[model samples]
Each structure stands twice: as structure tokens, then as C-alpha cells.
Target: HGEDDHGVHDGDGPIASDPSWCDVFAAAAKNVIAEVFAHAKTPVETRRQLQKNKMRREAARQTRRTKVVRQTTVTATRDVQLQNHDDHRVTKTVSGGASPFVSAASAMQ
Candidate 1:
């Protein structure tokens, strides 16, 4: 009656005590481990690819930023040069051109 209630018990012994059950369990565990490793490997490779893409995008963005900065710097330099040129022309006209006001003041003196 003790063995009859336990349905897993074969004529020889319990199914848990079978050597074939141990082999089946071991094979199932190995398969699970292999699947885990396979899943792990895919993510690592995907991460590496993602990282490389990120780096490439960053590099491209940096290049574009540098180009913009260079263009702005060139424009600013040109504007400064034009301002200096205009200032120089104004100084020359004030110093070298004869003014009627200056002549009249000198005559009064």
C-alpha cells in the first residue's frame, strides 16, 4: 500500500532513483546552460556594435561642430579687419584733409 500510493515507483525502484532520470536531468541542465551562454553572447556582441556606432556618431558631430566654429571664427576675423580698415581711413581724413574751420581759427589768431 505504501508503494501503490507512490505512482512514480517502478517494479525495480522509484523513478527518482533511476540512473536514466539523472542523465536526463543532466542533459536538460546542460541545454539550459548552453542557451543562457548563447543569449549572453548575443547581447555582448550587440552592445559592442552599439558602442561603435555611438562613437562614430560622436566623431561626426564633433567634426561638424569644429567646422562651424572655424567658419564663425573666420567671419569674426573678417569683420574685425573691416572695422579696423574703416577706422584707419577716418583717421587719415581727419589728419590730412584741410578744414575751413581750422584756417578761419588760425586767421583770427
Candidate 2:
């Protein structure tokens, strides 16, 4: 039938209308234009994402470095405090060549 030549007449047909050459060409051109724009912006978007990732990595590395420095500082302070406490202790020799076992604290009492 002539109707079949134009397009299917079935009410349940998937296509609403037959595609003309003009419509096909316009659709293809639109796709090509969109691809061109996307291609042009690809490098800019990639560089932006890379910069963000690098910043995040650098921030994490700085945080880790700060934590280690703080921990080392605290440990060094505690060691110096302990050393100071040990340095305050005093030892003395007894008369008649006795073993030098008496501490300054015991002598004070």
C-alpha cells in the first residue's frame, strides 16, 4: 500500500514519523557539534581535576608530617623531663672506704 511506503500505519509502531534526509543530516550535525565542544573542553576539565587531586594529596601529606613532628616534640620533652629528674639525684662515698651506696635524700633524713 502507499501508506506502507511512507511509514507503518500501525498505532503501536515505535517511530512516530519517518526520518527525512534533512532530519537525519541535522541530527548527525548536532551530534558532531556536541562532540567537538566536549573534545575542546576535555583538557581543561582534566587539568582542573588533577589540580584538585594534587592539592588533596599535598594536604594529607602535610597533615601526616605535622602529626609526626608533634609526636616527636612531645616524646623529646618527656625524655628531657625524665633526664632532669635523674640528674637531681646525688650519690656520695662513705668514710673508711665503705661502699658508696647512700643517696643525698637518705643523708638529708
Candidate 3:
């Protein structure tokens, strides 16, 4: 820890190409690389845990899908609102151009 965190050295020590030095250098490189990749798994595991926590939090608020939903102010409104169970599509006009896959509403008629 006394030395610089980066690999760069100010030449306070001898710069040598000796085989033993190379061996030590290779081992240190391997250790640092392994440690970096080891920490890499932690973030991924944390994300998975966070997603599971969100799912559990949602489990408490969930009720029957057939129940009426009146909290439009809290949640975003589905493009199409269904009373019972039917899923409908409500087309919205984007002030911009449409996706290349779909034709414009004016063109369709």
C-alpha cells in the first residue's frame, strides 16, 4: 500500500528483465486480474437480489386483476383500459414519425 496504486513506478528500484522478476510480475498481474473479476460477480448478484426484493414488495400490493383500478393518478394508464379481462389496443399519436414497421393512420385509411 505504500507504493503507488497504479503499476507505474518512479524508478526508485532497479529496472530489471530478470526471469524471477518476470515471474513475480506475472503472479501479481494474475492476482489483480482475479480480484477484479471476483468483484464483478458481486454487482450482478446484488442486482438479482434487488430485483427479487422488488418482486416481493409487489406481492403485497397485488390483488385480483378483475378488481377495479381507480388510481390513475398513481400509476400510468394503459393505452387501452379493460373493464373485465379483455386486452385492447389504444393507438396514441406521437407528434413524430411512426416506426418503419407500422404505416401511418392517415395512410392506412
Question: Considering every candidate listed, which one attains the maximal TM-score?
Answer: 1
Better of 1 and 3 by TM-score: 1
All candidates in order of TM-score, best leading: 1, 2, 3
Ranked by lDDT, the better of candidates 2 and 3 is 2
Candidate 1 per-residue C-alpha lDDT over 1-109 given as tens digits, one digit per residue, 9 for 90 to 100: 5746656533567766889998999999999999878757787778788779999999999999999999999999999999999767655665887467555544666
Model 3 RMSD, rounded to 1 decimal: 17.2
Local distance difference test scores for all models = 0.80, 0.71, 0.58
lDDT of 3 by residue, 1-109 (tens): 4555455356434545467888999999999999777657678777688779889878756753324365653354453344222311213323344544334534665
RMSD of 2: 21.2
Per-residue lDDT of 9 in model 3: 56
Q: How accurate is candidate 1 locally (lDDT)?
A: 0.80
* Residues forming the 10-long window of minimal summed lDDT in candidate 2: 89-98
- Looking at model 1, the pairs that clash are none
